[model samples]
Target chain A: MSDFQFDKIALIGIGLIGSSIARAIKLHGLAREISISTRSPLTLARAEELELGTFYTESAAECVKDADLVIVSVPVGASGAVAEQIAPALKQGAILTDVGSTKASVISQMQPFVPEGVHFIPGHPVAGTEHSGPDAGFADLFEGRWCILTPVEDTDAEAVRKLRSFWESLGSRVDEMDAEHHDKVLAIVSHLPHIIAYNIVGTAEDLETVTESEVIKYSASGFRDFTRLAASDPVMWRDVCLHNKDAILEMLARFSEDLAYLQRAIRWGEGDKLFDLFTRTRAVRRSIIEAGQDIAEADFGRHIRHEK
Target chain B: MSDFQFDKIALIGIGLIGSSIARAIKLHGLAREISISTRSPLTLARAEELELGTFYTESAAECVKDADLVIVSVPVGASGAVAEQIAPALKQGAILTDVGSTKASVISQMQPFVPEGVHFIPGHPVAGTEHSGPDAGFADLFEGRWCILTPVEDTDAEAVRKLRSFWESLGSRVDEMDAEHHDKVLAIVSHLPHIIAYNIVGTAEDLETVTESEVIKYSASGFRDFTRLAASDPVMWRDVCLHNKDAILEMLARFSEDLAYLQRAIRWGEGDKLFDLFTRTRAVRRSIIEAGQDIAEADFGRHIRHEK
Candidate 1:
């Protein structure tokens, strides 16, 4: 147990998720050496300035050379490109994982470039802030959050266990599932909600009757909640929208259909229908709270978090 | 300054908003006597158990008798009936107000029943938790928040000023606007967001491929932000939908239109279009944070608010 540290760990793409993993690795002393790389030179410089890694490189290939663990934290669409860059450099028996939101797509994108002995496990930390970039990351970003790993059938169980333990060391509770099932689950829980949020905030911005000032001033009413998700990284979410197209479109159709039903009910003065739906959703909130997914306090505990 | 408080204040509904007002009044000693009334006997008994007022009664008329201030905090649909019940007993020169989300409809619902000398100022505190009921309120609910007062043109100037100061004392910044304008503003800022939240949550719950249990388990990924708004008081939200029908419907139409455009972009693999829209929306989020309407921390500062 005392010798369970990695000889070398490499991080490709040092955005919020990547940098967070780097910080967590440093804090827990989980690795003998941390190699960090990102496409943007400015970001690499910032990462070095922040002292987030023991080794900094702009080339993904150079950074992952001889590394024991390699974590790719890029947009889903960039997974393949990054995987191709670092494939030859990944050490034998090294564990390769990603923190992409969509598992099936990332796995499919990154799998073809994988070396024979490298274990490619697709994982998503299921955690984030609306903010992005290296500076936005923190050590506790993955603390107590669910980190899901979707490995193919032929993957080695020992390699999977090692990757799971790595995430656990970062304070994550890990779950294992198939990639397709993970995509479907994330479509409802993550992608659809983000798309809805982005769409609604876009709608508010285009409103002819209500000024943008009014929306911003009174946003605490509810619109502000959606804005947080809407503020998420564009390139990442766009990739999610494109990669998870079927699932999202399915969700959008169902959500629109449900919304249309609600619209008709509102038009026809069907208070009972509205009341029933609203009440039912409240139970879902309570369940999330009970499951420790969300806080039980009112307004997300704004009064306490935003104490003036 | 000590003598500026109301001699007696009557609160017609003792739910979240009303009870918060009761607590704030007690904390600030803003009224010589606080009289509370609700149509439900059980809630009245509970308010008594909580000792929220100097007087408790079931009769709205009896509650408002001789009160210098009357605040009717019931659902918008019930505003008319509450006004009718308490009008005859309202003292001359009394300042009357409400905390309904919709302004124009509430003013219409409550206007005709107001006595000639009673100043009926329709107001919305623009503050709340998703939780409801007498126990789900606190004095800090209104602190650093905005309270919009939609006083009709014929409302007395002194009465408006007095109501403004009263809300200010409770730590609110008061803004005066036309009732119709207030309705339009709230339609975008509050009603549409909540309707969309309720609609999406319902959609997730009714999913065929994705189980409700999965949504509950993985909800921390964006879906949970929405469940907060969806968990709001059902009856109150129902009333808001019915009374603010036109504005809400209009905004819903716009939102759906925008969503269709987004869906098309997603389906066509239009990354640039998706990225552009996503990027534009992030600015709205920054504007909201800058306006001091929401907390700047990530995930609504959930980490700080929900410390494990």
Candidate 2:
């Protein structure tokens, strides 16, 4: 606990991340009253139908009024707008945070619009599935996941600590990193991977000789893995590409360079080069499993997992 | 049924595919006697210990003697050597098949050495897990998966029918294609994906800016999906690259072109361009699910899957 129970928690965008937060909060009984607001009226009604919050509204301003913790869970491009609308309504000393994938741009986008008395701390929970919307969330989404908080320098230490505790209560292990560094790290780990997945799937679909049905039929051999990532929410990923432009470009450059090297190896019949690269990557998967980040089941246990 | 019982079945290379076929055959009680062999003594011993077959041998020749069905499940690179070794001992009119990824290369390598009366069929069962070896096999590995056969024009129809029936009994839907066409199709669907996955994982590992631990900690966001493909057998991927060079290079060139276009879009802040591509790719994923090629569960249903 942050020494005081959160009287009311306002979720400013009830999408996958926001709805998951609502579920987790309700499951743990962490909030006295949960307020959820999204710009889309249909989504707001859906949130109400899902019983995701005690208060549901389409007005971002109405969602944050009198709330002790105001969490903005919108696209990076929409963050500033939500912050601007909710700024005047946020209760004094209320914590303001976001669950955006990118951190540095998010801080810049919402930081200026944040009211002076509100303790604005930027947080990104490194968790989600390809599915989106209010219906796509679950209470355990954040469990055993890493949530990185990139609080600005000169921010209140008490606010950072309490925010860290808040995420910890939500089943996340929190780590602190500079916002710029966080962007760079996520560029390689998250943004670049998503971009690459989208690009490859597009490439596969656009092929002239291979039929769509054949690609689908044989996807289990390998291509199916990329589709899961490519299926992520388009708007969210578009904002990610736009907001973290520099870092993502840097990573794309590196990935292209590596791909060129690999292409040359394949062209020249350099089996050892291909073998060496392939062999080295197996270790990374092993490390991820050892770190308890992934399940060790073969074929991701897709065969057995489907039974349930 | 094939109109005749499989009197004696021989499996060469008791790795993941080989052992899985062994299990599937046993599960269906499709064969009267099963013989397993691998060049590696330890793996052969493991198959024996696992009760994968009624007979085990170190020599491919000895393993296939008088066998009515012989399956070569070794790495694609090993297809030639196994076919040569087993040719002399194979029974007349017996069905001979190899479960190699690159059908053209496997056909080229094994077709010459195949005995005249033996039906040499090159097939690829588009199913497997990242994990390899005998212990990784299970009866259901091929269930609801596609198996592509690329048989030469002069091959016996009855033999091909029997082989198709065998795979059907093992729970695969069979499709026939020309060897060159099979290469091209798999190059895009399977080969290119694994190469890109391996290349990206290698690039992430080689980076100095993002610590390896950081990549591991946050992999679930998107990077983990690639790791599964990257962790696939090194030698198998190497052979795929070498064997299907032209088709793979073509797909790689197209993928690189698409990636460059995407990179430019990101650099120029083309949100609509990025958004359109991201949204369009989601449809392919939907098609894959509708085709019954992938589970529709979010994040591959990884959370619910872990409980078991």
Candidate 3:
């Protein structure tokens, strides 16, 4: 209790990210009190059943009234509305932040409604699974993960440091970047991948030649990887795509042009071109593993050890 | 060993798949003697250093001369050349099989060169990582995975059963399907995914708007999964794209069409369509997990438990 940083932390959307933060806060004793709020009563009841927070409220305003820190974890598109709803109730000195994937858009949406004296920092913890909702969260979800904060100019240094330390307490290595740059980088890395995965899986679903059952039976190849990403929360991804349209379309155009080149190379039997690109991509995977971002082996070593 | 199935097993082309088979054979004591052969001297020396076999040979002809079982594990394009080299040396009535991804291409290439008394059963172990070479081989690579056999009608029944038992010994579930069907199923499941992955990685590589370093930094969002798939063996995958051109092209066309629909949906803000497809793809992931084809979490939960 002596190590706890915040007297109370209010989670405004008790879904995966919000519940995960709640769990981590509870596990690490980061907050003395945790308050939860969401739009739906069913979800709030479920969160209460799980005891994800010390207090449950139907009103976002009520949830944040006395909280020292308020985290808005909702779809990126809904940030403006959430911000407006909670703006009047936010404590004057409260450190306000968000866990949205698209930072620039979220900043735009949330900045207009942020109350004076509240530190409004937008963030994205680049960690999640295909699952969503309160039931899908775990305490260690942020362990060894990266959480990016997009703090605007003129933002209070003390407020930013407090939020950084809070996330650091949850086992996350924090990085700060401009909101626009964050959106652009995420477009290439996260947004485009989700869009392409959704597109490919949708393609397979609509295929007349390849049966759905057959696709399921043989997905161990490459398709399953796309499926895992595509399986991400639908509303969340749709909002991300809609909100980050410019960055996404730019990345998409680049991706399509490169794909056309590859298609032609394969069509023309230009094996050298194909070989070079394939060889180069391997180094990137090695770098990722070396960076501790991902494991090198596909079997993930766990199943291998279990079998042994 | 009393439980050893074969007195000797000859492996041609000791690359990733070939070397993995050698390791599994040794670890399980499935073969009393393992003879390894590959065309490249450097790879052969490396295999020897790794102690992958009981005997090492520069000539495929000499390697299979006295072996009870011969497994040709090489790129699909090289199947014919290796088959021709080993044809005259194959022991009479030896069980000859291959672990090739494209069954039709392997069968077409090797069928003519297989001696009359030798049983040439085409097989594909639907398990692998992006990494290659003899050094990538692991003893438990095939554990709890799938092995698909495409046996001709005239194939010897005893040889098929024996090969099935051998794969089972390595902890792989064995199933049988026709050669052409295997190609189509693989085209959608495995081949298209690799092609898409390779194409997307290439797309990201060529982007002028987004730097390569940026793509690499933010890959965990989703681009990284494609990198893993794209990083797979180039020669092996290039051959797959070439050999299964018709099916691959068909799947690609279907994929592009579906992508266009998704792009249009996004452009028009069609949330329902986007949500529907995303939800459906999530179900496919669940099926894959239930089928025991993949870890329910990321790559068998390696990243999740790595720190522990």
List candidate 2 stretches off by more than 4 Å: A1-4, B1-4
lDDT (Cα, tens digit) per residue for candidate 3, span A68-87: 99999999989999999999
Residue pairs with backbone atoms closer than 3 Å in model 1 (clashes): none
Q: Candidate 1 chain B, which ten residues in sequence have the lowest lDDT sum?
A: B299-308
DockQ for candidate 1: 0.84
**TM-score (all chains, Cα) for each model:** 0.98, 0.98, 0.94
Error of 1 at B135 (Å): 1.0
* CA shift of B277, model 3, Å: 0.5
Predictions ranked by TM-score, top down? 2, 1, 3
Question: What C-alpha lDDT do the candidate models reach, one value each?
Answer: 0.91, 0.91, 0.84
- Pitting candidate 2 against candidate 3, the one with the higher DockQ is 2
**Docking level of model 3:** medium
DockQ numbers for every candidate?
A: 0.84, 0.76, 0.57
What lDDT tens digits, residue by residue, belong to model 2 across residues B1-308? 46335989999988889999999998898998999999999998899899999999999999999899999998898888888888889899999998999988898899889878989888999999898999989998898899999999898999999999999998899999999999999999899999999999999999999999999999988998899999999988899899999999999999999998999999999999999999999999999888888899998888775531
lDDT of 2 by residue, A1-308 (tens): 45335889999999999999999999988888999999899999999999999998888899898998888999998988888888888888999999998888898889898878789999999999999999999998988899999988788898888888888888899999999999999999899889989998999999889998899999988899899999999999999999999999899999999999999999999999999999999999999888877889887778885431
